[model samples]
Target chain A: MISLTDFLIVSAVLFCIGLYMIVSKHNAIQILIGIELMLNAAILNLVAFGKYDRFNNGGQMFALFAIVLAAATTAVALAIILNVYKQYKTIDPGKIDKLKD
Target chain B: MNLAQMLFYVMSFIALASAVFVAATKNLVRSIFMFFITLFALAGLYVLALADFVAVTQIVIYVGGILVLILFAFMLSGRETLNAMALQQKQFISIGKLPAFLLAALFLIVLLNMIIKVDANNLEWVKKSIESKNDIPVNAAMTEDIGVGLMTRYLLPFEAISILLMLALVGAAHLSRKGRGA
Candidate 1:
């Protein structure tokens, strides 16, 4: 019998790791990965809590939408990253100072 | 412990360990592969949480779709970036990343504290659900229920998501395609 707390702890750890990745990683793609991780963590929380919701299944439904949105966001982000690479010839977000004026 | 509890721990371990590998590994390709394992483990966790449909969706969309997109982006980018990433294998932690490490540690501590304070086992709704036998049972078939809810209660947001997906598809294609006025 795994309590909801176990899942919450796991989700929290995952969220922190994603936050670290987003803050520390230099590459844009790595940041995108971190964002995915964070979103997954949130979705995990939703599913964990949804366990108690027997009738509506709202958590699972919301998780589905979240997953779809994550996919869409990832697609758009990667495309943007590709263009950034093409323009700058580097994916290191730190060096892209074109608009830093 | 029971089978579900054991499996739950195993899946969480796999998910966390691989996620750490994905975060710490210097090799971009290896990290991506680790991410694949992470997503699969998360799907397993979802299954343990009694979300069969969501678990399947996790695998199909995350492992099948997103990972492939990431790999394609990696390939299309260039070799030089990979070389740059490979060269940074000397130190996992440095002064430059100290702030990020601190922030993550603080967040983890706060979240753990909150979760511990909440003590989920004694929650009012959980107790009520248990008393009424309204909680979702293990190995329940969620697909039919989910579909019915989507068509009925969640129909508007479902249609909105379809529109959003279409917009994203068009947007991504347009952004990635070469423009003439460059």
Candidate 2:
């Protein structure tokens, strides 16, 4: 039977996979996908913990806020990435090195 | 296992698989589509976990609002052929492979160890808490409670978020206009 521990384990694995993607990929949009994965991992943990929080549903509420914030952040980040593409003509973040010191 | 347990496992598997796909896919459009699928599956899991309101909000805000914005950004960002043709290559740069692998492995080990250390004895306490809280059970029908809570205790934050959203909308429009040289 699946338990909280199983959920936590899966979330942890997902987080690691996301981190790996963020570290390895140079594409801006691909990096955004990785960030989304990491956010989803945290949301899963919040909901799993909410299962035990029978009083106030605090964890579930937090998950809702998290989902909204993730979407908002992604929208803004995409806008920035689009602008970056306009200036650089490419989405490879490694090659968009105009600001690097 | 019962039907609920079976469904939980199915939904969880779908969520995890989609999450992995979101990370692993190379195409930007495909990755965003996978992200939508992942969010949808997570909403289903939220419903299963007895958070119906949260599930509905997830659908409306994420699927309806944000995904549209992302697609718009993708379309409006100019010279699509250039981005489409540029191929990304994997290069091991300054960040060494050994350190990255070691850090991720260490994070996994620590998280698993913590989960394993959770006392089984606490299971009975949790069950008892669930049982005794039946009088004030926060079930699917707690929509009224949520409304009341939002209006009363969370009024400031709710208003603040609305302001933030308005600012974001204005800022996005301004930035996009600047991009168009208007």
Instruction: State the DockQ of every prediction.
Output: 0.75, 0.47
What's the lDDT for all of these models? 0.89, 0.70
In model 1, state the lDDT of residue B73. Answer: 78
Give per-residue CA lDDT, model 2, range A1-101, as digits (tens): 34667677778887887787777676777677778778878887787667666546567667767887777677667767767766777777777777732
List, residue by residue over B1-182, the lDDT tens digit for candidate 1.
99999999999999999999888877778888899999999999999889988999999999999999999877866786566556544434464788898999999999999999999979999899878877898767879999899999999999999999999999998898877532
Instruction: List model 2 lDDT by residue over B1-182, tens digit each.
Output: 88767888888788878877776555667777888888788788777766777789888987888777776776665556334534443232434446656677788788788778974325775677667763224344756756776677667777877777777676666655664652
For candidate 2, what is the DockQ-based docking class? acceptable
Poorest 10 consecutive residues of model 1 chain B by lDDT? B86-95
What lDDT is reached at residue B42 by model 1?
A: 96
